[model samples]
Target: MRAPHTATTLGSAAPARDGPAQQVARFGRHVAEMCAVMCVTLILTGLAVTAAAAALGTSNPITGAPAATAAVATLALAASMTAWMRYRAMDWRPTLEMAGSTIAAGAVMLTGYAAGVVPADALVGGTCGLACVAMVAVMLFRFRLYASHAHHAPSGH
Candidate 1:
């Protein structure tokens, strides 16, 4: 009275039987995409900060821009983090935690910038860089887990 086991019923392990080469290629594509996202996020954050500083008429744009630049970079980084999580099909817990931490850090940096304790460029650049690095680290960790799973999974055939 039970249904027979089929490829579809076997879940992901069914498709993964294709072998390691396919798995590596899939991971490679993910790595490439992650790199591209990071690059674009950094570039866009820099441009946004520069434009914000210019628009605000900061005398020494690099060091004189308002905390707004940091805020903008934080927004961009949050978006990137969300995208990375979605692409990896990860749970939202880490994404939420990362977003919270990023926002908190950004707030601290903005406060420091406002208090003249840190340069605007440092605040914006450091926050953006840190966020991107964290994202890449998360992606790498996920990939390692995936690879390990694939390695241990039983061959469907």
Candidate 2:
């Protein structure tokens, strides 16, 4: 007698994995996390600029020039984001990777400013804008790190 068919259907069957909906949900969660981290970084960078302006008693140019402001803001952005990530108990590698990428982007812009290639208005736009873009680029390059559910988990949970 012929054997009845079963759900197993063993030969050449595809391995079960997350459905499309589940994949989209996970990606959405990661995007939210990135947004939260970046928002915090930008807010902190603004506070840093405000504090510098207040201390200097002038807003014409923070730290005496646009280039200086760019450098300061870029560092602040990197530091703020790194601090927040570490607070969340994220892995050190990615944290440092992000910080390094931000600093590098700022350095490029600063160089451009020095060379007179970057306009003063662009610097005023905030160096963190470029640094933030770099951070997102790094995230995309390291997709596996950001895509995995474990990376998004809250610490001590």
Q: Which candidate achieves the best lDDT against the true structure?
A: 2
Give the TM-scores of the predictions, in the order they appear: 0.54, 0.71
Q: How many residue pairs clash in each candidate?
A: 0, 0
Residue-level lDDT tens digits of model 2 in 44-114: 77677777777978665644577877777777767877787776556777788888988898899888888
Candidates in order: C-alpha RMSD to true structure:
8.3, 8.9
Error of 2 at 148 (Å): 1.0
Residue 97 in model 1: lDDT: 58
Model 2 pairs in collision: none
TM-score of 2: 0.71
Please list the residue runs of candidate 2 whose C-alpha ends up more than 4 Å from where it truly belongs after superposition.
1-16, 19-21, 62-64, 124-126, 152-157
lDDT of 1 by residue, 51-98 (tens): 766787765555665466667768776778667755555446655655
Query: TM-score: which candidate is best?
Result: 2
